[model samples]
Target chain A: MDVLKINGKEKEFTAGQFPATLAELLEQLGVEAATVVAEVDGDIVERENFARTRLAPGGSIELVRFVPGG
Target chain B: MASIDEKLRRAVVGVAGLGGLGSNVAAALARAGVGRLIIADFDMVEAANLNRQQYFLDQVGRPKVECTVENLRRINPAVLVEAHNERLTAANVPELFAAADVVAECFDRAQEKQMIVETVLARMSPKPIVSVSGLAGYGKSNAITTRRISPRLILIGDGQSGIDTEPILTAARVGIAASHQANAIIELLVDEIKASAP
Candidate 1:
């Protein structure tokens, strides 16, 4: 199982069983796409490629939500 | 006295997004005569943004960076506006923020925020990055707080508020967060409270 940490919460997903795309990961986690952005290992994943991308073990992922103000 | 204006004239701020927060931040900076602004954002205004955003109905479909630039220039013609219509990334972060006296992290995503914070911290620049968090759906306005994470990093927004499966966000919360960000920037520019400590 691979650990997916968002903000500070950790979740487990079977290796190679998780969605390949960022969007898929968001959907699986029940995250709002409009309010959040994905970062894999400290790099922002473009919205267009979030769905086609795959995750690797020990790789930390963060899903950040956009706040209304600074 | 003259030196203050001169310093302000030479100051450049890098704003990494142009959403509601970024747009308002940039606008406030321009109005304050910050001299130079490097605005970067890759989003376009949707019809849905008219609710509380500073865009008009006619501006829908325009790139956010473009719209913001137009607005900023109109507000202060003497201020320099360098608009970048691309997303800020690791490869470009250095170049984007190289000359900034202060960097405003107006991004909406958490991953990007952490990446940016780490990137700036790992670098040699003394420029401080002020970041925002937790302004979703909006009732916990009083929960919002500001912390100077480091001499060079400040995080604005409520420590307790978040996307709590409720309709919490409204124009009020957004304004509060943005104001905090602006004040942080102004403080960084004028006050060396931590840096100048004897």
Candidate 2:
């Protein structure tokens, strides 16, 4: 099994069961890509590049969204 | 000899909205003796904004950027303020904020906030941006806080209390978040100074 840390929490998945790309992971998590910004392993993944950025085992990802109003 | 406060006075801050968060953040920075400010907004003041925004009753119907400039100057006459009376778009963010040392994302809408943040991150890489989220309604001031997302990005406000909730936005809670944003900017500036020091 492989694991990915999301927003500071660890979630485990079978090997090769993890989403192949950041975009897929976001979709699996039901997060609207436009509403949140994501950083994987300390590097920001630009919105347009989410699909091309691959997720590796033991990787850390942080997704942050706006709080609605100022 | 230049003091640390004087170093703050030498930095330029760009504020992208003049509503609740932007206005209050600008005012806080001005009071803190920040040297220069470049503020932008296209909306005029309305009675509805008086609840949690910085403008007074008399300023309603006036342009927010104009009122904000006047108020900022009143707070610190020595501070230089450049007011832009126009809406911010991704196309103009780089040009408008070219002179800013740090940019504050103070928009009201989620899409707009995302737009500004994306624009800044894409176009102005490495420039620090202090933004807010979730500071809506009253009570539980402790809920509002500041989080550092990256070296260039900081998020402020209670992560959960948004406008979609029950109580509604008020002066106290919003002010707390605004202050947090302002203080975060100061802390970032101090860190920058230290990092650049010999």
Candidate 3:
């Protein structure tokens, strides 16, 4: 069982459903990558590097949409 | 404590986005005795902005940066104001705010706010970036609070009240967030000062 914590919620997945890369995780979650930045296990991952970055099993991921307004 | 004003006066601050948050932050910083302010805003003041923003009716049609300079100077004639009447981009944000001790992210759009926060945290690590989120609509002034998102990133606001949902931007509600941003910046500066005090 590969359970990844996204934002603050915990999502469990089987090996077949688990996302291999950070990009895949974002795509699986249907989050737009063009404007969103990812923090995987406290490390800031740039938008362009999402494809090459690997997701850690049982790691925490915070996909902040960045609370809006001024 | 007597020298706190001297310290604030010697420090430089940058304010990006001269709308409701930016304008009010600039004013509060000026009043707080901060010596220099680098303010940027590309848009012109509109009549609709008068509802919540710090701009006046006569100032409408004028560039926001220019009006901000005028308004800030009126609040504090001694405070030096640096006006940038252009949009801040990814390439330029780091450069524009490099000289500032602290940068205030007061943009309206979520993407722009994220960009500023990311750019500063990546390119200019250790330099604090103060931002506001979800400062739209009326009531719940108590809900507007400041949070230290990271060691160098301090964000202020309700984190839920956006224009898309609340859709009503009142002066009182927006001012609460703006003052929170201003106060957070002051706290950061003062904290640094206290840390170095010997």
Candidate 4:
């Protein structure tokens, strides 16, 4: 089993359940691609590359969401 | 051989939108004697913007970038201004801010804010960006504060007050948030000076 860290929280993912790509990771997390920015393992993953960027098992992720305001 | 004040005068700051936050930040930086300002905004000065933005009523209907340039000149004629009367997108943000020492994120909507932040953080790493969030209503002036999200990103505002829920933007509150952002930018510039000092 591998542990994935998202915004500092840890979640366990077996080899089969682990997301293969950043896009799948975001989808499983219920985060919309439009409203958030993703940084995986200290490197920012561009929105266009989400579907192509592979997620490293046991890696850390930082997802920032923007709320409506000035 | 330049003093900190002289360095401030020679620094170029990019303001990515000319709404309440951008307008005020530009004005403040100009008054602080920051030498060059690069401003971009696709909007015109509407009467509604007068409440919180640093634009005049008579300037309404004029492009915000044009008004900001004209007004910044009045605030400090020695300041050099580069005005862009266009919207900023991920494709253009990098080139537009390439020459800036620090970039300010002052857009109104969530998507626009996210775009600038993402573009700057991903594409313009190490340039430093000061962004605002959740300054929407009145009072609780103390709630608006600055936080360093990372070494390159500084966020200013009460983390929870949003325009979507509050729907009220006042001069005092918005100005406070804008000032917080501007001050944060100045502090970063000063920190650079400190880092390079002998």
Candidate 5:
């Protein structure tokens, strides 16, 4: 099994069947690319390069969205 | 030999907004005896801003920057405050915050917060930026925590909470986050001074 930690939660998937890139992972998670910022394994994934940024087993991802009202 | 309070008095902090977070943060810094403050905001004190923002009823219709400077002076008459009654933009950030030892990003909008953070990070380099996000509605106070995003960026407030159906901003929650931002600025200033000390 391949496991990824997202926002401090562990998510499991079938080995070799996990999303190949950050973009695919975001789509799988139902996250809109424009609304949030992504960080994979402590590296900021620029909006333009999200599709090209590869994902790996045991990787950690943090997605943050800005909140309104100060 | 300058005392700690004197050191704080000599520190100049740039507060980028005079809203709830910025107003409270600036007041906290002023009360703590921070030497100088550079505050900016183009908005005026509206009745709508009274719920969570730091302003009296009589303050409505006055420019936020002016009110903030006046209030800060009242808190600590010796504190030097420079008020800019203009909206912060990427083009003016460098000059506006040139003397700031730390910049507090307190815009209510996400895009504006991002703009100031990116601008300060790119232009200010080593100067720390303390910002707030996801602090809205009446949520648990513990949810407001500070995270050191990078060596130069520290973010306060729960990263997931925001205004939704409630459409409310409570003084309790916003105050917690504002205090967190203020404390982070103080910590960063102390650390910087300690690092540079012989």
Candidate 6:
């Protein structure tokens, strides 16, 4: 099993098996309902594949959530 | 002061929803010479919109975005225009704002306005948003004020004023509110106000 450091949290999961959608990863991370936006390396991941997308080892991710006000 | 030509050349503005406020906002921006604009609205003109919208009776049945682009083009043929004939939602907001130097939230629905603001703020989109609220019924011009919710967010309209109660139709009130919005945007483009300026 390997871990992906997301934003700052390190999540450990079995290596080699990954979801086909990025949305699935969000659900696994308990962040599907968090108004989360995914940015892989410096570009944003389109919503079309968020649910079926997966992550690879050493691929950095940034999950942005909206804050109330402004 | 930056010349009108210089001010327009560097601006990439987005106006969402073309109604009383949005229509006036778009027209004012065009008249002020904004270099580039992205206008989005899925609505079509209704007979009821004859009051404040800068549209004629002949424009009825045309898409708001299309009509806005047409009207703006006629006003300033040299300005660049991109019209999106779609609703503004969370899904398309990012792409809509990706190249925008500034954004205006003209949605009459408070919920929609909140959604757009939250998304822009969350993404740290780097452009300022000029938002509207409380311009429903107008009696006193002094009631309107532009408040800075953050360094990058400016809110127009009167505090605690609801659109439903005010019954917006006349061009006067909507025009005032739109002017405030356009003024804030011009100030934003020319660096007249610091990000810290309220």
lDDT over C-alpha atoms for residue A63 of model 3: 66
- Show what share of the native A-B interface contacts model 4 retains: 0.67
- Quantify all predictions' global Cα lDDT against the true fold: 0.71, 0.85, 0.84, 0.85, 0.82, 0.71
Tens-digit lDDT string for candidate 1 (B1-198): 335455566677888887767878888877777788988988999887666566778899999988988888789989888889998886788887887778888876666765566566556356678888866555666766777654566778864355444364465677677778877887676654222211
Clashing pairs for model 3 are none
C-alpha DockQ of every model: 0.12, 0.70, 0.55, 0.58, 0.43, 0.03
lDDT string for model 6 (A1-70, tens) is 6666676667677755554356767777666333444566545565454765666765667654422211
Q: Write the per-residue lDDT of candidate 2 for residues B101-155, one digit (tens) a residue.
A: 8899999887788778877876787787888888898888898889987777788
- Name the best candidate (by DockQ): 2
Which is better, 2 or 5, measured by DockQ? 2
| Best TM-score among the predictions, by candidate number | 2
Error of 4 at B124 (Å): 2.9
Q: Assess the local accuracy of residue B187 in candidate 3 as a C-alpha lDDT between 0 and 100.
A: 80
Q: Which stretches of candidate 1 lie over 4 Å from their true place?
A: A1-70, B1-6, B163-168, B193-198
Off by over 4 Å in 3: A5-11, B193-198
In candidate 5, the residue pairs with backbone N, CA or C atoms under 3 Å apart (3 or more residues apart, or in different chains) clash, namely B9-B35
Candidate 6, CAPRI quality class derived from DockQ = incorrect
Residues B126-182 of candidate 5: C-alpha lDDT, one tens digit per residue: 677888877887858888899987667788888767665346888888899999999
iRMS of each prediction: 6.7, 1.3, 2.1, 1.5, 2.7, 8.5
lDDT of 5 at B63: 97
Docking class of 4: medium
Worst 10 residues of 2 chain B by lDDT: B189-198
Q: Which prediction has more favorable lDDT, 1 or 5?
A: 5
TM-score of 6: 0.70
Which regions of candidate 4 are displaced past 4 Å?
A9-20, B193-198
lDDT of 3 by residue, B59-176 (tens): 9999999999999889999999989999998899988998788999999888888788778877786788897777888888888888765577777888778787886888899999
Q: What level of docking quality does candidate 3 show?
A: medium
